[model samples]
Target: MSGAHGRRERPPAPEPLPAPTVDAHTHLDACGCEDAADVVAAMDRAAAVGVTRAVTIADDLAAARWAVQAAHWDERVTAAVALHPTRTAAVPEEWFAEIERLAGDPRVVAVGETGLDYYWDHSPPAAQQEWFRRHIDLAKRIGKPLMIHDRDAHEDVLRILREEGPPETVVFHCFSGDAAMARECAAAGYVLSFAGPVTFRNARDLQEAAVVVPEEQLLVETDAPFLTPHPHRGRANEPYCLPWTVRGLAALRGVTDERLATSARRNAERIFGLADVPPAAHPWTGGTDGARSA
Candidate 1:
């Protein structure tokens, strides 16, 4: 149902997946989660649909702190801290220190949602590039994966990564590229995380790109509170909506949903070290419907 201003209502939860999956990138804080209980309820909904774990991204200092707290509060949630390229324009240089401090937490699994966002000119290109390099350095020094957010500046992003030498593992969150770019990233061994847009009927280029990604390097995300997948596009989104995206991607890749979910789960675990994390005692850990992950 449409609500005020005709904003589409949240879609009903889809059928649970055939196997466990992980929301490789998201923003629980943006999904209207205000406290531990909200976080728990969000994860509970995700767990119901076989999304066993999630990496909540922080785009600013405040979000970074909240992300870490969420990670520690609910074992199923993990954090990625950074200043989004758009936000980098106005934030003080000193704020980055807070991001760095938060990044060191064991609960924080990655350093990103950073990188260039040329599409939004909120930040001058120079400032965005400068901070992108700094975030890269932070990831390298701390030995965590660097999650990128390249928009309309893929070549520059790659060039900078090569210039500074990329961290051991790098991920392109909400990867928006065609087949050729996919090949370039795959060749460089950078993980590509497809989000809800992959389910859009008009996203032929992205669909083609998704098919070409090395199975091992492929990932899926919600990027929720935005980019809600097809049949429900323009609607509100959350981790629970991941099934539609996963199912769509699986179809494009010529695989069963279970196979894709299993792959995404394994890839996310390896990249984020989610396997070692234990969920809250009372909640379902990694499971399909009510069944636990093995």
Candidate 2:
């Protein structure tokens, strides 16, 4: 939990924005919320700052199941499920079937946090690409958006997405590409979901990339418990800190705080198909009965 300067805690919440928005991607589990009550408290903090809803994503099967229950427990949360690229190897075969089954649940909104991660050599590039294609196909089959995590493998990610044919709604989570790459993604109609990295002073290229994404193709996320934006970088992050990233993005895109929030919310609704209606609840109380019934 420790970050730069040996700090292990989050900073005070920034000033609230004037209108509500959705954190397109976040990881409530990594934030260490122990149970439904704990998750709701985190949501309350975020809602207080105009971040009224969030899509909690999973990096592996175990987390995906938790994400599904978390989403059903609260209307303000949605879930995205997928195996992280680095952790793809060593997973049991049933895990893939489980993920495919979970994808059918209305509470599970997207298939993601999936894609290549060349930054780490944990998984071979071939395995990552193979799993990425599987997830992409799954997203297409389920008719849900595809949330990608492309770290240091932009070209390969884009190439595979093209080769497999991207889903109707494709989102690049924590988009770290330059303006040219952003334009390439935009041309292919991919949504660029910016995270805390866009707020760093040295991320000028990323900032410029943010400016070119059409309002409808733009999104903002906390990617909570990591990438805690500028001025508070390295502090443990939670959804309440989204406003820092939102405001920073607004400054880059030359829009008012309310305008950016409004557009981001609209984009989230359109892509995720929420449109103000939460998915039907499929609550699981940690037993075979709930899982079986669902």
Candidate 3:
């Protein structure tokens, strides 16, 4: 059904998982959420369906600030701050300083959604690389996981990570590589976060790669407000829809949904330092769908 202003409504929520997991990457701000209450409702929606924890990511300076605030708004939410590659065309030195400041916050768990994006020509390649290096350094300095967003620039992203000496915990968010690339990343001790696209019928290569990834290195995400999973591909995505991706991945890997979800949750907790976070109350009566359009 259409929402207000004739926007496409979100798909109905998938069934809750047998075990809880974390959305390693998402953007609550992009989901049209703007305040603490909105963030809480979104978290509750996700929590209701066993996505008990989440790490919302920032794609630009404004988002970086918003992410940290969102983290504070809900204990279930954590933040990853960065200036996205596509937005690096004209970034000033001060912007990096601000990102550094945000990264220092206790609420910020990772430094990223950073790396190369060759798909969009919005930013010059040189500038994207320059800032990518800066974010890498910041992640290393802060002793946090480095979350990377590698679009059509896989070679360069890998090369730079090798050259710079990646952080102890590196993650390729929404990993888009095939089996060969997945092996390379796994061998390097980097985590591969698979988002909704893995469930698409045309994504045989991704499914193949997902099978090759070690259970400990695998993670699942919604990339909410985008990349809605199969059977709901064209609709607005939200965290509650994450179970579809998890179930699809579990089937591909020939594991029980509980086992896959457990491993993914452990990997996220270990990487993002969420090991100490207490579980949110599981009030199953809430809307299975995520926060609705206002």
Candidate 4:
């Protein structure tokens, strides 16, 4: 029998699987994987593990473009654009305009992954502060949420947020500070997002922070391609591993996994404008189980 074009060439790579929980934060550009294809495959793996949504952040224009394009390929994925604290000095004046342009795109849901990182000091403190303020302003002007990244610069970050008066939805992604800081952020009505480090034995302070954060203001993330949890420690982190972080937070808060997971999902949807996210179902009972019994 004759065949059309040698058997239709095997139908390209199947679309990547979808995730169960929303990963609120991640850096697809930093996974150290070879290229976009590798990153997409990683995301697919994450989806298979139940990570239903993810916010892929970019620290610069090129990376932001990559994030935007990545979202185009996956419905559950979205993008966040801004100059990271360390890279702030290198950004051109027109970068703000570019960010504004990107923010207007529906896929670009948040204004940052931006804030202070005094721990590294990769850029001058002043430059980092200036850029951070710019991102906050941009977020406000665009009426979108802001994803903040603070490291050893909490005082200034808080001060700036107060002075600038951040928009309604603000998120502290990869929140690693003490309980006091968590309380302060929560008091200000900002969402606190925990990452893989929350599962570490030595992360007692982070555990404390997790316990005290209000349920409605709490979130969980992978921060992947980095901060892999304990069992997978030192390995390249990925979104599929978010359950470890979520379980860790649940243990810390003395709440059932179902309660913690539902709270985290609700918080993520509220802050990220993803209210359309369906209720999470327990794996064992399939869809009939609904959320885990509290």
Tell me the deviation in Å of residue 194 in model 3: 0.3
lDDT, residue 93, model 3: 85
What is the clash count for each candidate, in the order shown?
0, 0, 0, 8
The weakest ten consecutive residues by lDDT in model 2 span: 285-294
Ranking by TM-score: 2, 3, 1, 4
Alpha carbon lDDT at 39, candidate 4: 49
Candidate 4, residue 125: CA error in Å? 0.8
- What residue pairs are clashing in model 3? none
Please give the distance, in angstroms, between residue 91's alpha carbon in candidate 3 and its true position after superposition: 0.6
Instruction: Compose the digit string of candidate 4's lDDT tens values, residues 1-294.
Output: 012311222222222323246788887656643344444566667766667778888877777766766565556677898888989877777877887787777777798889999999679999998899888888988888899989898899999999998888899989989999999988999999999888899988988988899899988888876788776777666677787787778888998776777777767777777664233221122223222110
lDDT agreement of model 1 with the native = 0.87
TM-score of 3: 0.92
Model 4 shows how many backbone clashes? Answer: 8
TM-score of each: 0.92, 0.93, 0.92, 0.84
How does model 4 score by TM-score? 0.84
Q: Per-residue lDDT tens digits of candidate 1, residues 1-294? A: 112312437799999999999998988877877667677888999999899889999988888877887787678889899999998777776798789988988888899889998888899999999999999999999999999999999889999999999999999999999999999999999999999999999999999999999999999999987899988998888899999999999999999999999999999999988766555333333332321111
For model 3, state the Cα shift of residue 235 in Å.
Answer: 0.4
